[model samples]
Target: MIYEMTIQFRVSDISKGQHWYETLLNKKPDFIPHDGFAEWELLPGCWLQIAEGIPSIGSGPLRLGIDNLEIERDRLINDLKIEPFDIYSREEVPVKWATFSDPWGNKVGLFEYHNQSEKEDRKKTIVGKQQ
Candidate 1:
C-alpha cells in the first residue's frame, strides 16, 4: 500500500532556495542531509524537498492551505516582495486561492476554506498527527 510522500522543487542555488522556502513556510527545514538539498515536512508525512538544479519549467503551483489567504497574501507581498496577484473562487467551490511565483520561478500559492468548521477539522487532524 502507498505510504508517506515527498514533492520536490528545483532551484539554481540551494542556499537561496532554502532561505526562500524557510521564509515562505515560516520555519527552518526539517532536514538538510547534504550540502545541496533541504527538506521540510509540511504535514506529518508529506515532505517538500528543494534541491540545487535547473528549475522545472511550468512545474507547479504547490498550493498550501492557510487560515487566512488575505493575510498571507499581504505578508508575501510586504516581506518577500512578491507582485500582487488576484485571488479567485467559484460559486460552488469551498475555498478561495491565489498563486504567485518565487524568485526562482517556482509556482506557489495559498488557499483558505470558506467553511470555518471544515477548516477547524483540518487543523485538528493535522495537529493530532504531528503529536
Candidate 2:
C-alpha cells in the first residue's frame, strides 16, 4: 500500500521555478535538498517537487483542491501575470476547476468542491494531520 506520494515538476531554471512556485503557493518550499531542487508538503502525505531540467511537455494540469477557486484564479492572474482563465463546472460535477500553466510550462490547476462542509472537513483532516 502506498503511504505517501510525491509529484515532481521539472523546469528549465530552478531559481525562476522556485520563485514562481513560492508565489503561487503563497509560501516558500518546505524543504530544499540541493541547489536545483525544492519540495512542498501540499497536504498530509502529498508532496510537490520542483527540479531544474526540461519541463514535461503536455504532461498535466495537476489539479489541486482548494477552498475558493475564483479567488485563487484572480490572485494568480494578478500576482503571476498569467493569462486569465475561466472556472468551469457541470451539473453532475461536484467541483469547479480552472487550469493554467506556470512560467516554465508546467500545467497547474485549482478546484473547489461544491459542498462547503465537505471542503471544511477535508481542510480539518489535512490541518489535523499537520499538527
Candidate 3:
C-alpha cells in the first residue's frame, strides 16, 4: 500500500521554477537535496517536486485546495504576473476552480470548497487541528 505520494514537475530553469513555486505556495521548499532539485511537502504525506529539465508538454493542471479562489487568483496575477484565468463551478460540484500555467507551461490550478466546514475538516485531516 502506498503511504505517501509525490508529484513532480519539470522546468527548464531550476532557479525560476523554485522561485515561482515559492511565490505560489508562499514558502520555500522544505527540501533541496542537490542542485537542480527542490521539494515541498504540500500536506502530511503529499509532496511536490520541481526539477531542472525539459518541461513535459501537456503534463498537468495539478489542482490544490485553497480557502479562497478569488483571493489566490488575484494574488498570483499581481505577484507572479500570471495571466488572469477564469474560475469555474458546476451546480452539482462543491468547489470552484481555476487553472493557469507557469512560465515553463506547467499547468497548475487552485480550487476552493463552497462548504467552509468541509474545508476545515479536510485541513484537519491533512495537517491536524489548528489551535
Please report the candidate that would top lDDT against the real structure: 3
Model 2, C-alpha of 83: deviation from truth (Å): 0.3
Q: Which stretches of candidate 3 lie over 4 Å from their true place?
A: none
Which model scores highest in TM-score? Answer: 3
Ranking by TM-score: 3, 1, 2
**TM-score for each of the candidates:** 0.93, 0.92, 0.96
What are the RMSDs of all candidates, in order?
1.7, 1.8, 0.9
For candidate 1, lDDT tens digit of each residue in 20-82? 899999999999999999999998798999999999865687999998999999988988888
lDDT scores of the candidates, listed in order: 0.89, 0.89, 0.93
Q: What overall lDDT, based on C-alpha atoms, would model 2 receive against the true structure?
A: 0.89
**Stronger candidate by lDDT (2 vs 3):** 3
lDDT tens per residue, model 3, 49-103: 9999999966788899988899999999999999999999998998999999999
Ranking by lDDT: 3, 1, 2
> Residue-wise lDDT of candidate 2 within 1-131, one digit each (tens)?
99898999999999999999999999999999889999999977899999999988765778899878988988999999999998899999989988889887789999999999878788787677324
Which scores greater on TM-score, model 1 or model 3? 3
